[model samples]
Target: MIIIAAVDDRNGMMFNHRRQSQDKVLREKILSLTAGKLLWMDHYSAKQFDGCTAPQLNIDDRFMWEAAPGEYCFVEDTSVAHFEKWAEQIILFKWNRKYPGDFCFDIDVQKPEWKLSHTEDFAGSSHEKITMEVYDHA
Candidate 1:
């Protein structure tokens, strides 16, 4: 399966996007990956498409509901054992821990809080539109 994942500053691995391909070979890869899959990921990978009706999660590995909480383990491609090795690596590396405090080299480390916004909030240049509307009304 052509699964593209990234390890974050927290060492946490998030598998979110599946690349687009119509070739029979590519489709087979996807099917094999999700056939016995036990985890689902979000749409972080959608950014690659610049914006398209990309598949969020393959057939069986659908997304989790907003009101519900779910957790999944990430497996590396080179590993022999699937999810088991990935989960073990995460625990040993403390993937869930906070960002490291110090950096010996010239590296920038910033711990920022995540801001959740409605999809509509990104519909347009909202700030500019609001200002123009207010001026017109005035």
Candidate 2:
């Protein structure tokens, strides 16, 4: 399975049960990438993609055990550490700013087994810039 999320410069994801920030351009990027694909997320995260065109699956804790290989999962509040064994890759959207956050990404992309395969930067409507990083799990 693959995972995707947006994190702040300090790797902060959310605060007070809400996303720290958002960008329309970043949302478009996600929609373009996940278009015609199966995107999985928990109930809370699902709300963020209200008008998304892709097929979305609202999942529960059993998602980790039930998701098939090659599936794509978009996570925000979900802890991704548990998916290391099954994850094929990870796509991280790095917002070029910091925000107060109670929750942060739990996985360590710096680990030896994960390789930073690609990176690209783009300006955002709500952010100065955003970097998209793709890490392949070996």
Candidate 3:
């Protein structure tokens, strides 16, 4: 499975069980990335994509365990570290700023087994700049 997440400058993803942030541009980017594919996300995360049309979505509480290989999982409150073993690729959309968060993105993409393959920055509707990093298993 391919893991997708949005993080603040400190790799923080959530605060008090809620997501740190959301942006219209980021949502569009995610939709574009998952086009023609199934994207699995828990019910909490599903609320963010309510009006989406394209890109099939599967809402399951056990999405992490249920997603098949090459499938996409948009993680919000969950700790993605444990699911690293099943991750073929990891995509992070960075907010480039700091936010108060309790749960953070825990995967050490710098580890020898995972390789940083691509990175790009774009302007977001709610944020000045958002960075994207794609890591693939080595």
- The better candidate by TM-score, 2 or 3, is 3
Can you give the TM-score per candidate against the true fold?
0.20, 0.88, 0.96
Report lDDT (CA) for all predictions.
0.24, 0.82, 0.92
For candidate 2, what is the TM-score? Answer: 0.88
Lowest lDDT 10-residue stretch of candidate 2: 53-62
Candidate 2 local lDDT, 13-120, one digit each (tens) = 999989898788887888778766666777777676677655545456455566667777877887888878888989999987889999998889999989999999
Supply every candidate's count of residue pairs whose N, Cα or C atoms clash at under 3 angstroms: 0, 0, 0
Q: Which pairs of residues clash in candidate 2, taking residues 3 or more apart in a chain or in different chains?
A: none
Pairs that collide, model 3: none
The prediction achieving the highest TM-score against the true structure is 3
For model 1 the TM-score comes to 0.20
Name the better of 1 and 2 by lDDT.
Answer: 2
**Distance from true position, residue 9, model 1, in Å?**
20
RMSD of each: 19.3, 1.9, 0.9
